[model samples]
Target: MPTLALMWEAKAAPGRAGDLLAWARAQELDPSPARREHFTAPGERVLVITWWPAAYDAEVPELPDPPQELRARPVHRWRFEQV
Candidate 1:
């Protein structure tokens, strides 16, 4: 089977990057991933990527939203296959 990668991204309110980062780090995903990573960017952005072994048309899991008060806006999510 081919591999699929799913990414969840969000930005925190002003001066709340650290809080968002902490929350992202402590999260766990069900149906456990084969690999994953967390990243932070300037301007209070946080990103998480999870990798799974799946067919091209497989149904990937969805990520939950973080606390409403912590984010600047709703999360953005995407998925891609290895080229």
Candidate 2:
């Protein structure tokens, strides 16, 4: 099975970063060996990287979904295949 790396670049509304992170943590979807990292730049923008098994990609699950409020912000996503 190949590993999949999911990358997200987004900006949070004022004082909403914490809420966004909380929503991300509360997701209940299951992915083997899943991992997540969060970063903040000097601006209010946030970067999140999530990884999981690529075998499950075709299922199009919801754990990867972003918060509704954050969804309105500019977001970019990419998937990388592991060698």
- lDDT values of the candidates? 0.86, 0.64
For candidate 1, the lDDT comes to 0.86
TM-score of each: 0.89, 0.61
lDDT of 2 by residue, 1-83 (tens): 77777766666767777776666566664543377777777556666677776653544343455666764475767767777
What is the TM-score of candidate 1?
Answer: 0.89
Off by over 4 Å in 2: 55-57, 60-72
Pairing residues by index, what is the TM-score of model 2? 0.61
lDDT of 1 by residue, 1-83 (tens): 79999889999988888998888878777777899898998889999998999855678665688898889999999888977
